[model samples]
Target: MELVFVPTPGMGHLLSAVEVSKLIIQRDRRISILILIIKVPMTSSILDSFVESQSRDNPYPTRLTFITLPPLSNCPDPSSFSFFQTLITLQKPLVKQAVTDRISKVGSPALAGFILDMFCTNIMEVADEFMVPSYIFFTSGASLLNFIFLFQKLEDDEGVDTVTKFNDPEIEFDVPGFVNQVNGKVVPVVFLEKEGGSSMIIDHARRFKKSNGIIVNTFTELESVGVEALFDQVSKNIIPAVYPVGPILELESKTRGGSQDESQDKILQWLDDQPSSSVVFLCFGSMGCFDADQVKEIANGLEKSGHRFLWSLRKPPPEGKVGMPTEHETFVDVLPDGFLERTAERGKMIGWAPQVSILSHQAVGGFVSHCGWNSTLESIWFGVPMATWPLYAEQQLNAFELVKELGLAVEIRMDYRRDWKTKKANFTVTAEEIENGVKKLMSLDEETKKKVREMSEKGKKALEEGGSSHMWLGRFIEDVFTNVASN
Candidate 1:
């Protein structure tokens, strides 16, 4: 069986696709894998680097192929295009033509199925035409997907104006499988908007309804309630098929090659030299860019807390520059005066660090995260607690799940302007709030530390052989593949 995995552009989406593809190859000896990506003009270089790295470290019997869809400069956002429409509408044929040509050469034996990103909905038509099954791969948590699925039902039942109550401060609605009634001002934000508040979500939800099956990057054990609730929602047959084969870090770690970059090696060495559970690592993700004021506030907050810390400061390039800050001096002016001198003995700052290795190290105690799903899962896997400061997208919702629902992290304050400003105007977290959150997590007192340690053990147990995630992954392979392929 040959499975062609198609992911939307972006590091997180592509990484999730790569991680799952790695696992699928491991589970089946006879199956072959190909990764299909849409190469946005200048951005194709990133995928080129990724393909080169993977080919050098092919851990599967199946060879990997990198095929590009023709450039679609006319699409509103070329990176966000779906399957058939984007390919069919383009002036010159790219994805469709290339795929059709490849199918002819590889023959039916090598044309088993397509594993597509959820946003790549148009692929279903092509899969049907080719007589191949296409599974939808959701790169976020199952809870998020469940919310998306439910949002469609709410919209259908309530109509577009279904809830004039949306803008209201608090609204309570009973979702099928959750234990508690969901409440929030932006509760329907998951399905209501696209591009984190645009009209794209409605279209994506529509696409989801037509998918063959859903694959999420989360395991069942970590969120039994949410996972079970998801199953319940789909049980009535209103939903497409779903599978939870995750704690995807397990697969990533397994396939991560031994070749480490020089900068990453330096970061690891610095982490190794720190005392166990003594340092806090702060990072706001790859795309998280702070204005000068916000950067100053982070420096002030960290200095006030007086904890040993390591931060990945990603300042946007100087005026007219294309990328991010590449030198240490770039942050000198933005940070507080005498900041390095005062914290010199206790802190080590870097432009970027080997995040996974640092999290796995014994010296790290807590994570200051942007609440991206991948970062959240990594934190949970390493048993390191988080200080959630979500910057964009469903991150705020994910933060709610972590701090309020899961009792796993602390949330910094965010400005909620029900009537005044638009959603883009995010108020910076005050130094006082950051200080308090840090003190709460880094408290040397054994009682608080013990509780966090206990939670970490629970996280570890979940990924083990008989753990919830383990069983769910096993069931996913058996139920999704074995049953269908044999027939």
Candidate 2:
């Protein structure tokens, strides 16, 4: 049997899709997988390197293929959230051709299913054309997943548009997966808007109802309430089945798993020199960055806090471009004057970090992170406490869950949203806020840390043989066969 996977372009999104593809191939000898990669204007260093290295490590050469789709030249434009949506939409014909070409080969496995990334829901039409089951690989947490569904539900039942429903930013939404009331302002910015990517997101949420099911990148033990709530919806036939086959993390990050270079050695050495459970590690997601003013505030805060730290400070993208920041140095230009010199002994700012490796190290105690779901799961797996600092997309919603719903992280600012079109945060997080968040993060109570540690173990067990995710993986595979057979 064969499975076709379509993934979007962001590094995090694409990376998660790769990991899941590898996992499925490793688990099922009966299944051969082909991943259709959408070409875009961004970095594919991690994916390219992983695919190259797989030739040696992979036992099933014939069972796996990562084919980059033909480029979309119509736009000749840069990458942004909304632009990426348009980019994916324009590639529909390319996607159909890729799948058709593969299935028509002389001796290929039987076509079984299509695994679409959240943004690639539109490609389900191709699956419909082929008479195969389609599934969505949801890359974020389950609470946000539930909220997206509920947002659409409310709009339909209330006869109100998204923006008007979110008219009062102070109003709290009683979403099922969340124990705490989710504030309207803290909801994903996409959910509050009515056009562009927001429209696409909502349309995807509606499309989700027609798919075979949603395959989440999270484990049941770590998100019992949310997972259970999703199943409740299934019991009522409100949506398709929900499969929690995850905490599917890349345990060995690219740097640690692939090659060790000079930078890796230096990062490890610095941590090796620090006291156990003393250093605070800060990394925003791949797209995480701040303006000059916010960067100065962070520098001031770290200096005042006097904590041993490793900070990954990315320069913002060009003033108005919709893109991820490149590796930023020249700290003297944006950081508080003499701040680097004064904190030189206690803190270090580096380029992109080896996050999983650093979190697994004993010297690291806390994470001040952007609460990207992948980062959040990575922190939980390593038992590192976090102070949430959300940036974009559903990240603010993820931060709110970590602090308000899960109690797994300290609050830096739950409602912080980065405005991409304009070059500003909805509000600036001051140096005082950063300092205090750092202080609290380092001195987190043993109880909260203990809870995180417990969840970490559960997360591990969920992926082990006969565990929750393991069982779900099998179940999803079974459903793929069953649905295809029925069709």
Judging by TM-score against the true structure, name the best candidate: 2
Question: Which numbered prediction scores highest in lDDT against the true structure?
Answer: 2
What are the per-residue Cα lDDT tens digits for candidate 1 across 1-487? 5777778766667877877777666665666677877765434565667666666666763456666566666654423324333543352245556667776874534566678887676666677776777678888887778777666666766665433545444667665545566666435343333333423565567777666678877776556677887787578776666787776653233222344365567777888888998999987765555667777788888888988898888656545333333423335567877888988888877765567887898999989887888888888777788887776667766776776667778766422221111213336677888888787777645654555566556656655778765565566566546535654
- In angstroms, how far off is 32's CA in candidate 1? 1.7
Candidate 1 Cα misplacement greater than 4 A, ranges:
41-43, 61-63, 73-93, 106-108, 160-164, 172-198, 250-260, 317-330, 414-424, 444-471, 474-487
TM-score of each: 0.85, 0.95
What clash count does candidate 2 reach? 0
Clashing pairs in 2: none
Task: List per-prediction Cα lDDT, in the order shown.
Answer: 0.67, 0.84
Would you give me the overall lDDT of model 1? Answer: 0.67
- Cα error, candidate 2, residue 332 (Å): 4.7
Clashing pairs in 1: 70-94, 194-198
lDDT of 2 by residue, 1-487 (tens): 9999998776678778878888888888888888887776555554566556655566677888878787776864553446767777788899889888988998988889899998899899898889898999999878888888887786766765777777577887689987878788787887766656556777889889889999999988877899999999999999998889988787756552523456767899999999999999999988788888888999989989999999988777777676667753423468877887899898978867888889999999999998998899999999999999998888888888888888899988888888755657888999999999999999999999999999999999998899999999989988887887788
